[model samples]
Target: MKYMYWLLIFIPITLVARFGLQLNDGLVFLFCCFGIVPLAAVLGDSTEQISLYTGPKIGGFLNATMGNVPELLICGFAVQAGMYSLVLASLAGSILGNILLVMGMSIFIGGLKYKFLPFNKNITHNNFTLLGFAAFSIVVPFFFKYSGGGGITEHSLSNFSLALAVIMIVLYLLGLIFSLITHRDIFDDEDEDEDGEKEAPEWSFKKSLSVMIGATVCVAVMSEILVHTVEGAAEQFGLGEAFIGIILIPLLGNVAEHASAIMMAVKGKLNISIEIAVGSSMQIAMFVTPLMVILSALLGNTMEYVYTPMELLGIIISIVIAATVFMDHKVNWLEGAELIAAYIILGGAFLVFGIG
Candidate 1:
């Protein structure tokens, strides 16, 4: 985790490349991508620190809201720029990356030490049930488009997206209530370790808030620069923005979660690792997607809920496979390998098929 802060060097490098030397867009894009990763890590860490000062319930809410701030900022900027496909692809990629790539790596690393990793079955089951519903919601607009047989108008799709976004936001809020309030015991049980050593924040509250705010502002600026370079970067690499979104952007935005989950798993805190993976995915599907939809609409560059058929199919299939993997409430290294293999195949498909 400390090593990630070394990436802070890229922040100055990106600025100098973009404005000082006026480097090529591809280089600027690459630098900004590296720059954002550590900023995101700092943002997440500071949020965790702040959560220590707040009580558990409020801390949970704070984590839930701040977990995806970097991704949301990037997508928000993309939405403003009318890069709808890029935003949508990034959202889908975040979901797949979390459930498959992050969780798979966590399980594989943890399973290497322990033959099997088990988590709270009932809690995991409930999380998956909500995840399944979220997946279904994501696919509905795609289904609506095709099922309409070319009769659906853009206006109607926008309207549908708006309405559905409202419903999703409501449901997501209800879910927060469910997990954090009425059933807090199930979700909050892992805050402490088996030996009952609950870690305390290392930074002062003022320092945490100041660092979080600073990181967020830096991420916002970097995201703007990053989005500005997407087209040139795509052209330079002979790739599509969708490919960049599907592969690169999510990785940049989620470096913190990816690192934290794997570290937790390695330490035999597999439950915390899975929670980070699955919970992050759920937040992307329910909270981030809907918030983006509504914000895009309000900003007059509306991003519909509709997705490319291939992209939608990949998300649904990933969710199903992930859910099935956890159904037995146990996982082994081989299962983790399978999940990683699936992600690789899907990524290759997105590359070959185009505009995922």
Candidate 2:
């Protein structure tokens, strides 16, 4: 973990280039991209450390809330810049990336070591249902758009999206209540400990809180630099904004959490790994996406819930593949491989077609 901090060097380099010298946008973007990885890792680590003190329920809630700080910052900046399509693409990508890429890698690597791993079916199913509902919410606005309802105008669509966003947020809070309060034991892996003794936190609460705050601040600064350079970088690389948003942004924002999930799986804690991956996706869907909708409106960049056809299709396919894999309550390396393969294929299609 100490070695990961070395990536922080890019932070100063990015700052100096952006402020001290007029560096190439591509180079600034590249440096900021690498720089954010360790910051995100530190952020995730600090959050987990904090969770150790909070216990599983509240800890899980903290993880869900803070896990996507980078994404939120990036998209917030994008929204301010009027890159609404980019913002939506990043949201979609985060959801797909977690459920398919991160979860797949975790399960694949863990399955190789464990042969087969079982997770808590009740928790998994509940999360799966929420994921499906979230996906359906996205689909709803699109349905209204093409349904030929003569009364549906831009204002009406925006209103529809606003209402749905509020509802999703309400559902998200209800989910937290359900998992963290009413039925926490069913969803909590820590409850499996036979001794029922909570482990002592390695860090002092102040230290954990300080690190989480510091890492988050650094990520926010880096994300601003990154978002500023995105347009130039996209043009320089000949990659469409949609492709960059869908693949590159989410990958950078999520690399730290991705590493944590894979590590948990490698340690034979499949339940924890699943929770990290699926819970992150659930957060993106239920919390992050709706939050973006409300934020965009407040920022005067009012983005509707409607997604491009390809983006919608990509999300639905990813959800279906993930649901299929987890349905049996058991997972093997083959299933993991399948998920990764699906992601790769979808990525290739996006790269080739540049769908927004």
Candidate 3:
């Protein structure tokens, strides 16, 4: 019955999309996101359970790789199809959306339901350490931006971008070292509810491992279709690739995460809710973007890391506000509202610029 339900729902959505590609490509592109992203999220989340159980570093690693499966798949296809800018902007947008929008909305709504929520502060702080470096990861790309270069194709540009990817990998490795070696205790779940300590869900670590590998496989399957559909949609809609990247793609990539955050909130697991929101975002930024670049390089395409001025501004503001709201040990309704509002402001700006 479960498999039947999934097949009935998801298969039609995908077929509607794949077939619709023959008629109206934009519609097909839209449905693919509406369809495929959720599927990948299911895969990614199942995989995440294994990662969480294996320990913090492994969990972080797993989430980092799989959290943005839809985005990664789309971007990889985009790269293969030669939509380099779209892939790059999508990476930037995914990070910002996951970190800022998903987390922000979850906090706001969850806090409104319950006045105060508790989370694993030590783990959050450890994640922040990675985020700090993630924010800094923007430096090199921005450096190349200020120089006279025409996005990825600019002379010596792809090399610089690739080099930056290498640097991010090294820094990420160091952060992992710091996370596991320097602060291993941060991952321990403290049973700390007033009524009594509740046991957390035990993840299917082996299942998650299998699914993680499976996600990589499915990604290869759908990417080609996604790339073709996106290009057709973009051309038909008269939308620029940049517009698609900075707005549509990221939001689509994160829909599953947004749903999970809300579900946790409804369940009254505020700490777990908040953890999913923030942890997922950190993974997107620190890990997903670099992986795309590496994969693009492997696929014989250049995934540039150029950010528009507004994109950079939005990212910086989102990270700062998100970090500030969560930095404290306590979370309240007001902070949640503020986070949501901040995201709204960013979203408004994106649609405005995206349509421009």
Quick one: ranking by TM-score, best first? Answer: 2, 1, 3
Q: Which is the leading candidate under TM-score?
A: 2
Clashing pairs in 3: 108-336
Tell me how far the alpha carbon of residue 11 in candidate 1 is from the true structure, in angstroms, after superposition: 1.1
lDDT of 1 at 89: 92
Question: What range of 10 consecutive residues in model 2 has the weakest lDDT sum?
Answer: 190-199
CA shift at 217, candidate 1, in angstroms?
1.0
Q: Give each model's whole-structure lDDT.
A: 0.81, 0.84, 0.66
Model 1, global lDDT: 0.81
lDDT of 1 by residue, 105-192 (tens): 9898888999988777755776677788888887788888889877898989998998988898898889878877798776654534
Considering every candidate listed, which one attains the maximal lDDT? 2
Clashes of each: 0, 0, 1
Model 3 ranges with Cα > 4 A deviation: 1-21, 48-65, 147-153, 192-216, 237-240, 265-271, 299-301
Q: How many times do residue backbones clash in model 1? A: 0
| Per-residue lDDT of candidate 3, residues 92-129 (tens digit) | 67766767677767777777777777777776786677
